[model samples]
Target: MHRSLFNILSGRNTRQGLWGLPLLVALLISLWLTVETTQFATAENLFNLVAQAMPLIIAAIGQLVVVLIGGLDLSVGSVISFTTAVLALDQPAIVLIPAVFLLAALIGLINGLAITRFNVHPIIATLSTQYIVLGITRILRPVSGGTVPEIVIAAVSGSFLGIPYPVFWGIVVIVAAWKLLYGSRYGLHLFAIGGGIASGAESAARNFGVSDRRNIILAYMVCSCFAAVAGVFLAGRIVSGDPNVGLLFELDTVTAVALGGTQLSGGIGSLHGTVIGALVMALLANGMNLANVSPFVQTAIKGGILLAVVGLQSRKKMGL
Candidate 1:
């Protein structure tokens, strides 16, 4: 009986200590909100929550990639702003779509090259790029009016059999990220780079095959491309391009990533955690809105919650 009881306790402890604990928190929040508000658990509201969370999720994914390489992309918001402005320009869809994506990818490449080849620090490099991109956005469309193709906007924001496209896309991205991070060798390399394992215990990884530089470049590229996707989706949703659309988006993405269990210092984290973090954030906002809370108060609440989460994680890491 003692052995069986100990085994049961151990199982409970293991569940409580899971890396996916944030997801459980999010679900608990959802349950609380549902109890508090009638509309919070409705199918339509749930779908809308997923839809609105998609852009943030995408941005967080990009941030996660860069963080996995022990890098930061302070320019994600600026890139989103630039892409939105570019999309706002009056141009044909076929040409504009490819052109804007190419430009975004090029910007990412430059960021990667600057960090890897030129040896610029990731934070400084991305910050400089952010300012440059913001300047270019101002020059391109000082105003907030630009036309997104009707079809494009509809396809992205509309629903399929009562499910929003953003939700579908978010699911797809999550699955892909999960598969890549946990199921493949490339993913292991990324973890090695971020974890500093390649430079330490797995030192021979470099000599045998792994290239940290290449991995870093690819990470930055993926980040920028994902940011571009968010930008495109935003443009479609609003049916216009606003230079200020994605302002402070980096903060949101970073906060989500950090809350999701990814360490800012790099190495250990989960993409699934990031998704749950995004959902938690979105649900918080939604719930607050339903409760008629002020935006300023909501922001404060979010910050407080984030601090609490980080604190708890830190204590856990310290074996408290």
Candidate 2:
């Protein structure tokens, strides 16, 4: 039994299984909701669900990259908050949009440098940055009242060929992330670094000529840039730049990544898994809302789900 379990959790079987599990879970949840309530299966509800999941889908994909490199960015929520605040200013898109991206990238660079150059722990580095960015975000917009450009809202929320723009954007992120992570040399280095960090094989990876620093920097940059994108979409959705909008987004992204079967210790994961994971989260929340579950209970249930998923991975690692 132990050997069989190991076999199931190892090799391509494990990868394929993990990649598909979230989809299966999401489907089951959708089916349950369809049977339990009339509010979940309509085309309008489906579009709304996809719209709600877009920012998270993008954020989770970005977080997956950092996780692949064996690190965490607790500042993603803060970055989103900051971006929304910046974008809320009555500035032109040509200026504010690029500015937000650059600011986010700068934050990522600093995070990478803190971890690589200064040897700061990833958690500490990101946590500190989170606080800094959040403070600035609050200062920028002490509250949630600011205008989001109407054009931005129309562009993000508009549909083409019967598909919402957010859903299309989510699909694009998934495909691009899949190719970049699973089909490129840089991706190889990232996986190597991640695996090395987890297994204490950094020397071996370096000897294999992996530029850990460059890959780590790039990973963080990608993560921040994606978070910024999510922020933009969120700003458009709410039509304002609320400082508190993305308060718990980091938790959601991390949980989604974990639920998707990405090892928290790093190395093994897929964008497909993350996409399905995000979908599962959206469905779960939708189901809960439809059931009239309390908001507090929903948070607790989500936390429990995260813990259970992470525990399962730990158990698998232990071959238990």
* lDDT string, candidate 2, 1-320, tens digits: 77665554442455322655676688889999999899899999988999889899999999989988779999999999999999999988889989999999999999999998999988899999999999999999999978877777887879999888987787777778878987899888888887777676656578888889988988999999999999999999988998998888888998899888788777777777888888899998888888889989988888898889878674223211
Q: Per-residue lDDT for 177-287 in model 1, tens only?
A: 788777988788887776664134434446657898888888888898889888988898888999988887877887788777776656656777788788888988899
lDDT of 1 at 290: 95
TM-score of every candidate: 0.86, 0.93
lDDT of 1 at 214: 82
Runs in model 2 deviating more than 4 A are 1-17, 315-320
How far residue 92's Cα lies from its native spot in candidate 2, in Å, is 0.8
lDDT of 1: 0.79
- For every model shown, the clashing-pair count is 0, 0
Q: Rate the local accuracy (lDDT) of all candidates.
A: 0.79, 0.85
| Candidate No. with top TM-score | 2
